[model samples]
Target chain A: MIDWLISGDRPRSVALGAVLLGILFSLAFAPFLFPGVRALDTAATILIFIVLVASYDLLLGYSGIVSFAHTMFFGLGAYGVALASIHMGPGWDALIVGALAGALSATVLAYAIGLFSLRVRAIFFAMITLAVASAVAVLVSQLFQLTGGEDGLTYRIPRALTPANRVGELFGVRINGRILAYYLLFFSCTALFLLLLRIVNSPFGRVLQSIRENDFRSEAIGYRVVAYRTAATCLSAAMAALAGSLYAIWLRYVGPDTTLSFEIMIDVLLMVVIGGMGTMYGAVIGATIFVLAQNYLQNLMGAASDATSALPLIPDLINPDRWLLWLGVLFVLSVYFFPTGIVGRLRAGR
Target chain B: MTQTLLETTDLTVRFGGHVAVDHVTCAFRAGELTAIVGPNGAGKTTYFNLISGQIGASAGSVRLLGQDITRMGVARRCAMGLGRAFQLTNLFPALSVLENVRLVIQARRGKGFNLFSIAASHVEMTTAALAVLERVKLGALRDQKVSELSHGNQRKLEVAMLIALDPQVYMFDEPTAGMSVDEAPVVLDLIAELKHDSDRTILLVEHKMDVIAKLADRIIVLHNGALVADGPPAEVIASDVVQKVYMGREIADV
Candidate 1:
């Protein structure tokens, strides 16, 4: 059914095909592509990062709000979900509740900032968000009792949201493992992606683009300029929270590092900008690139370790802690050659 | 004889000690077509801005239908039965011509927050928008994207958008500035029709003497941010000050 829907090239068919393909591809490849804690951890990092970037792009790319505090919303989601889960214990319902909590908390925070700063466009809005994120990070770190401080919190969870009672029985076949978890996350990501796609194509989406093109004209037409900005801000934040909540659930752990880390924020930004800021599929492309690059690059370094330890080119010369430096260089290069990112370049070609 | 629908009192706008608009006072009455004529830098556009609330009045007040609206924002002022067609074409270019007009109708109805519904599917709004487009003879171009429309059509679209809101008072700043000779009469016809509507008031800033002489029932002449003459167009245009303002100090030689 999904394949038939995807194979058709009409507008509706194209949309459905893209969505089904996304879901199928993610579910089919997640296990083999990302195995064990190390691989799963890296893949998870890329997934959450992509979600964050997509959330940012929804506002910055479409609505023209350059927000730097996107990580703050991600943190809010992570912290909100983790805290909610800690008090309630892990369950299918608990995960849903946690996601909702994360979204609500991020929305509230975004609302406060948006109410005051939506009037300030471009660099000013970006600065305000950065300040807010830094402040939240500081507050989280100082509150060791509730947050478990820098070390973070750990949890044990049932194998599944419903806790598969018959571990190896799914359609009379085996379906018990981390593969199930991967498929669960893959579905979640795809659902959010489709919802975003619907929003950007709608009338409301056109208005947002109009706002981006020229705000004064939008106001002249009686659209409340600030109101649109606020709504977009909250919606973007909520999407980031959804991603964060998934991360907490998948890992069964949450902490300040997950929420407040500068590294996490940059990673998300990289995915969106490198993949294509405004294009809907840019986040997925970005995540795939980021994950593949990190995996292969690390493996290449490991392979060369025996031969190059005496005259190490990267790890010895530059602190491994600064692996982000290389990512920064890549970002700069992408900005120079493909300012619109991959999706943007493809759009320009078309 | 018609009641004043919009008025500005001693409207002074200053930019860093230089007065852009200096103590200009005017009133626009329902059923009246008024032309404000001045050469470039005569504060005509500044006065329009002050009335439209695009920029805050440095020291003055604006009254709309006898209510003080000095502090109101542009959107609120628009919602309060005031509409403006800009000197420059200000429009949503990516939207279809019909959608552009529908925006103003939607604004007047104040249903902008129906997030779940498709905007293009709003039947009543689309009908109203198309009606205005038809009035401007832009109905044929309704489905075309605004960016695809020609400059004159875009200007007509701007006017149609303003008309769709059904404002009690319409402010048009140089409405025919970029129009061809053929296009100018269509705008003149629309303005004349608007003036004849009995309940509609029109205020315009124009340099075109032909339009001013043809359409203006009352003409207010300004020179260097001050009123030089205010009366019927024949009387005001006949004034030596008005003749000199138009002829640039060489009317006697001409």
Candidate 2:
């Protein structure tokens, strides 16, 4: 059965199987999962993280380019949706408009930065993106009146998914609660993931790989290196924006703290690196680890704090404040033990 | 009459104050084997770089089949029918030999944007790419990863890539630079076959005297970034300037 699942030539089949499994698992344990929040919230976090990480991998692992500003696109998408909800009606229009605005803004930034930085390779290109992101972060923080500065903004949204919806009925399930949101998020990820599979296997994707391997030889073959890289960057940004928009709707809030945080960047980086750079499913693995670990650590810490004087051992065992420190150690260990990342090591063994 | 495929008139490539390739004019005509010979610092490789559009020419113009291509990019020039094999082996090390050839095949087919089509779906291009590999006797190694191949095999793969493009003009920089005595003839034979049988317009920069003597229909000698001699092998090799350039002294015995 395991072999049957991964045996297909089409990457879509694998993605389909993975999505179906995730949906099934969530539905089976829906009652026990996040009682106050819907199953959809869980799905949303996974979907958003997966999309962000995969997009980051496409650029970093496949194209050999890094952008610190990638999270800026995610932030913009969330902000756009929040601002739209505050000003426009909730339904689907605000979501669409917000995503478009984020995409357009990211594409514009990608084109301008791509024009200059694409000529240089490796560290220089990485630094250029870091510089751009830092500058943008400063700019966002300075827009105090419009952006609500450090405090961030919150926007109201109508419920779009519940366990009793029509989508849930297809699976003999009800989406009247959070379970419906999980289905929506799962379906979106599956669809976008299928599209991503197509894009990665395409001729354009080969050119991107060729650029990664040898830019001069690819140029010799008549490919405009900059044009293609910029296209990938824009596509990656746009997909990330979609994910971000969904995130905003799921949380019903938006803030510069979410958009401009280095934590988001670290998560995306970790997803691509530890999960296995260049592989599409790396994002999913990375996101699962991150979200699950955060939830577990926070619960452990909360339990310890509640116990106060008696639970010194438990506090020491699950320190929430030291998560980043642990994460850094994990990254170093991953690099040392599996230099090619997880998937790369598996492929090499084969 | 056959046409000229590549013509460089007074081409000079200057880096700062130094002339790497100075005022070199040469025409590479179809069905002719042209050899460029020079010492280590003689700028022969630089001349190839200028013609291949790898570097900008500070003076003069390069024409491809009568179209002025002085400002054309390397990839554009390649599409216009210029193929170049580098002095160093530059095959895609991570890919299989066949995959590397398939990449060029896809480029030639201009199907670089087709996402839905599987790689195996490119039957005709794959067949042609395979045929080119077969021609270079690299067909047996097609399934092997390029990095796994020996240095000589890698060079053969590079030549195979050049051939797979079916370019109008083939530029080889030191085709046998790292080849052993036994491996040198394979390259010489390929060059001879390209000239005598396939009628390819060939421009090569080689240090191997025996290979040059065997294959060069016409030889042009370079010294200090300038062309010193251009003629048939015997006349160019016997010239006072050529002899002095190669031996660092006049040929007193001759």
Per-model CA lDDT versus the true structure: 0.76, 0.75
Per-residue lDDT of model 1, residues A310-334, tens digit only: 7747445344444456556767898
lDDT tens string, model 1, B1-254?
Answer: 56999888888889998898888888888899899888889988888888888889998799999999999888788888888889998887776888788767877787665554556556787788888889989999888998999888888888887788788889898887787778777777988888878887899888777778788899998788888889998788778897888785422222
TM-score of candidate 1 against the unseen true structure = 0.84
lDDT of 1 at A266: 73
Candidate 1 segments whose C-alpha is farther than 4 A from its true place: A1-24, A27-50, A92-97, A162-166, A169-174, A177-180, A296-337, B93-99, B123-153, B247-254
TM, every model: 0.84, 0.88
Candidate 2 runs further than 4 Å off: A1-40, A162-174, A298-322, B197-199, B248-254
Model 1 pairs in collision: A6-A17
Give the lowest summed-lDDT range of ten residues in model 1 chain B: B245-254
Locate the minimum summed-lDDT window of 10 residues in model 2 chain A. A3-12
